[model samples]
Target: MTGCLDDLDITMVEEGFTTKDLLETLLKEASQRGSREAFFVADLGDVVKKHLRLLKALPRVKPFYALKCNRSKEVVHLLAGLGVGFGCAKKPELALVKSAGVPVDRIICTGPCKQMSHIRYAASQGVQLMTFDNEVELGKVAKSHPSARMILSLATDESRSSGCPSVRFGATLKSCRQLLETAKDMNVEVVGVSFHIGSGCTDPQMFTQSIADARLVFEMGAELGYKMHLLDIGGGFPGAEEAKGRFEEATNVVNSALDLYFPEGCGVEIIAELGRYYVDSAFTFMINIVAKKEVPLDQPGSDDDDPGGKKSFVYHLNDGVYGSFSSVIFNNTCPVPILHKKLSPDSPLYSSSLWGPTGDGLDRIAEGMDLPELHVGDWLIFETMGAYTGPASSSLSGAQPSRIHYAMSRVAWQAVQLLQGKLLPPEEEDQECTCAPLSCGWEITDTLCVTPVFAPASIM
Candidate 1:
């Protein structure tokens, strides 16, 4: 797959349609099928490219994809096929990865406090790599899986973490010695150290500091007569295009830190658990505008006293806080909207507030947005939605969570075939193919083909 794409000078394989073009096509198709709510369009080609980018930027570290980000089987299967490992935090996520045919060794069960049953199940399934930050968890592991390989998780600098996990997980520096001693006493193997700088991390220095902290833990374990070989740098990588500069900065810092702390041939294997970095920009969400209301506003300094002189528009969409927009409330996400139809520069703009379909007052999508006046039936699109969106959406208020539609460019499929060491069908060598299961509500063409896996009945 690398060789096939290395010869091509293109940044992204031409899928024969821009995002707007594909959005329009899908909107038309959804209208015909009577889909009143939002749906997702996943560009598998983009996802593959992101993986390549990660390899280029941080070549030394292997990434274990966090399934909590986007658990679509299609995404998981594609990553697994591409040789990416899986990071499962829950039993179901582990089951999903196992169902995708991922090797037991390629999966890591990563949660600070894991269920006893889950620990037993993982041990039974041959998943030896797990994480712990507290004494109780160590006790659980020692009793349930004595021979299990463990990674000690340390608390990161809270100021550097965007979504700080120190408050909930991670052992402090002062507590690391005691934990290692306990593990040594219990005869539980402490084979590595791990720390999360939090999700959506912005400070590159955080990584260097975390690495320094991990080094301390590594030395502490070594003093306890344990051979530490693994260093799990937990997830916090940003996945948005706007964060490219920050990501690069952080990657450079991580590379430098690895060289300084765990240099080449140091007998230490490095790995990362990245969630949003792999899939955030690979999806585009389209939501339908079901209703709208015009609110009259009075301008304090206007010569005309008519309240109608200034107006604010309220838009009601089929998906809301309980649905894909849950990220707005949960992740502190602020998704910007792109209209299906481009508005003229001279077009009138209004103060608009986008609302979710739910009756709850907190189900708002966006407030005080400046947008061209839109009518009912128009669509609002959100990008960089693949992370922490789909899996977190709920079916509250009778609003079904959005369905995912996977589309891979022709070049992407070729890359997949190359990576999997499979020959392209003779008939499909020069022509595109449209294949969809009868049960799915998709109309795929030759150029852009859809994967058969639809949205699961339940999300993460």
Candidate 2:
């Protein structure tokens, strides 16, 4: 069975197969039977379940999984199965989600740029909601699809945006008002007001500010005799763990803003489009170290004088910035990579930098971070990689993006069933034991103890 599962404390359902055990078995077989190059193991099912749980927890808010995050067909299909709507940025994403049998009504056509073909396709597909920032787009929609439904995105706190509305997205309050009035004149249905506070935002007040801005626009729309039918709070929610504080703060702001603007029974449909917050932490990247080396570091003097030298350990992994580490570049955060092989608790930790397989100078994933000195053939597992790691990192470069391997267990169910049956097996009474000689991605070269898949107490 998987020693990984033992560490994770997951019990398996199949006879003698703990979740880790199964992964171990798979890795063992794959190493011998499959390509050595990296591939992501997308546990499609687990990702969906986690998103569903988040959605359920956020009552009164619907999730429109940002398709720009991870566009994997498997991921899209799973989100569809979970009944989560999609926030599509372009034609391909729209096509991918639609191809998965997701009804057009369930998709929101989002994105700063709108090509004629994509917009026309969205209109023809009966997309219920699209966002626009200016009258030019309104005129385009009016010229192409007069009956298309759309949202007027209001620019909020330009000071907060790196480039503001000029970032080439969203219209100013004045422009939004003009756009809505134009929609009225052109017979286009202006359904709602939408705004984005940018991505990787952790402050809920930013959302509150956006909401307040939307409310002002709503009032403006009302003065112009328009009854907005929707409030599309565009994607910005953080993942369960990574963005928890931010999400909570944002939620409070949103709830208060909604109360202040449109109380319950206001007849306006409220929606939040979340991407990173919903999926980022639900996945992990498990990659094997293909090679390792000692690289020297140059220490430069504070001035133009002494350029003394420094030395540090560098571990090159299969995945890098061109792969799944783009989040580091974007989020200013590096995922924690834990060593899978056993080590002395007292062993001295070595500071090192993580690098990808690319020979390019910019291919470094992490630069000079403190981590255990690792060796070749060791496995490095980065947790909380579910969000932008997959689609954001995948490339037609050396070794395609890593594949995802999924694991889940009905621990509560097994416990309940065991109590009802009341018959304890020998495996249930035995002590817990895990495997040894661990390798990355779970290629088990040796066995230490026989792992019990199911034990009454353990399951409970």
Which model scores highest in TM-score?
A: 1
List where candidate 2 sits over 4 angstroms from the true fold: 1-23, 31-35, 39-57, 158-168, 242-246, 299-311, 391-396, 408-460
Per-residue lDDT of model 2, residues 306-332, tens digit only: 122233576677777767777666556
Candidate 1 regions exceeding 4 Å error are 1-15, 296-309, 391-395, 423-460
In candidate 1, what are the lDDT values of residues 1-460, reduced to their tens digit?
2123323223332445555566667788878998766788777777766665676677788878989888877788788877789888899999888877788878888887799999999988899988898889999999999878988888887764556457568899899999999988888888898887766556778889889989988888888898999998877777666676888888899999999999999999999888888888888898889988876554321123332346677888888877787788878877889887677888866777788877678887777667788999888788888887752445464655687776666555555564466733333333444442222222222433233233211011
**How many steric clashes does model 2 contain?**
18
Candidate achieving the largest lDDT: 1
Candidate 2 C-alpha error for residue 433, in Å: 40
Q: Rate the local accuracy (lDDT) of all candidates.
A: 0.75, 0.61
